[model samples]
Target: MKLIHAELIKLASLLSAWIAAGLATILPAAVAVLNSRSQVSRGIDAGFQDLAPGVIGAIVIGVVAVSSEYLVEGAESGGGRQITTSLTAVASRSRFLLAKAAAVAVTVALLALLSSAITLTTTSLTDETVSVGTADLPRVAGVTAYWILTALLASGITLVTRSGIVPLTFCIVNMSVVSVSFLLTKLTSWANYLPDLAGMHLFLRDVHGSVDIAPLTGGLVMGLWVVVVAGIGFIVFRRRDA
Candidate 1:
């Protein structure tokens, strides 16, 4: 509990966290409003489509949370990294990692819920044609879960690299408007199995072509990927010097 509390406090102190949280809350609404006004018609899955870019905020949150620990304060002075202090205080790498992950999970989950709600509400208000039925509840929940998993995926990747730039660049680029995965899907059906592509199946009801999998199965596949990468990160973090 103490470790988790400390981790939360540490996250709260970062400017990046505040920016990420704000983006997570605002981007969805902005996208929804744009979509509502656009003359081009979006199909039934418009809601999810508008909300998708908001996940970038969750990704940033995850990467920043872990990478901040490795930052050097003053190269000339040789001030130690924050990870050194964190490990010294906790005295257990595994415990500290767990606390960090827990803090990230909780924060991203709340952000996801807030973003989803705001997006859904904004979509309904701006576009009366868009439905907000109870039937869509599962899709909303799936989006929340997707954000949490994506955040964890970023966290795990950051742990392995010990730097935010690599994971953040790759994730944000791959998830952008001209997504690498989307382009790859045009070439090979197997691209559907990519982590982001597969996970999006959970909430995306109208994925036009490539490959189709059950929502639960897609979640499981993405979760497995996160577990494998996170496991490798854990091993490296345990054996490596802090």
Candidate 2:
């Protein structure tokens, strides 16, 4: 409990978290407003609808939470003073990482939920799209889980490279490439099993024209990936000199 509080404080104290959280809120809100204002003269565009503002804003949250560590040694939120404070508060490396991960998950989940609400409400005001409902809960949960795991995986990669810029750039490129591949129908079968794909599969149910992977399968793949990456991160963090 103390460790978690300490980790939460460390995260809350950082400028990066403030900036990322603000952007996470504002960018999506802005997009939702724009989407609401844009004319929908044609038919319902499922593709545009699937590209929800929350989903896009999550990309930034994912990158910053994971890669920010590299920018400030021992501080996932990125600041020298806060890093020192965190270390002084929590001596166990495993505990520290675990606490940080939990903090990030909680904070991001709240952010995602808020952004989703904003996007849906704004789009609703436009009358072009109906707000997502209980039927969409499973898919929304999946996207949130995927975002947390993706951030953890990014952290693992940062542990390996120790360069924030590298991981941040990689995330942008990887997401873009994945988005492009999603446009190819022939690949949806296997692509549906990919880490991010599983989440997207749930987000835009019509992407593959059907759910290729069951929701359970998607959750399992995402969970397993997080476990594996976190294991690797733990090993490296324990052995490496900080």
Candidate 3:
């Protein structure tokens, strides 16, 4: 228990982690509120239903949280040697990783919950006649899932690359863009099978019947990605020097 707590503290000690988390939760929420007002004037009573764009910045947060660990150096900053020494003191790598993952999950989930609440509340306040209900639950869950997957992938990539900025760049430019477009067509079996494409279906449920992929299929695809990425990350973390 002490070790886990220490690991959590270590993860939180970085300035980037807190900054990323703050931006992830706050910026999107602020935009969601603004979008609600604009949508109202456009005869679109949907409110912040289209605030997904604000969440793109969240991927950067998820990536930076784990990557920042590699940058610490020397006694004052808890260098690479300190990490290995701490692992020895802690007695188990799995437990350390678990604690780190737990912190990541908790942070991302909280941020997502806040963002969703803002979106829902803003939409309701703006659309006098429109009432947002629990129907948004699935979409909210999809966003949460996206956040978790992003964190897991980022942590694993950071472990392998050891450069926070590099993995963050890939996540921002490649993963975000690629995932957004994974379900554009159904021509190939593999295209929709990708994780983001699958998860995106849940968010696009309003048009799932007309779209190439079904919501259930999208959920399944995202699930597979989560499992695969997490499994790989766990294996790598267990073997790495850390």
Best by lDDT: 1
TM values, all candidates: 0.95, 0.76, 0.77
Report the number of backbone clashes for model 3.
Answer: 1
RMSD of 1: 1.6
Give the per-residue lDDT of model 2 (tens digit) for 58-163.
4555445545554445456454633345556678887888877787777778877666666556656665455456766665565566666666666666666656
Clashing pairs in 2: none
Question: lDDT of candidate 2?
Answer: 0.60
Q: Pairs clashing in candidate 1? A: none
What would the per-residue lDDT of candidate 3 be over residues 149-212, giving only the tens digit for each residue? Answer: 6676677667666666776765666544554344444455555566655665666544332347
Q: Looking at model 1, which ten-residue stretch has the lowest summed lDDT?
A: 205-214
lDDT, residue 200, candidate 3: 59
Per residue, candidate 1 scores C-alpha lDDT tens digits across 1-242 of 98999999999999999999999999989999988998877878877788889999999999999999999879774777899888888887889999999999999989988888889888888887887878988988889889989999999999999999999999998887567887888999988888898898889978754788788988998999899989999999999998
Predictions in order: lDDT: 0.89, 0.60, 0.63
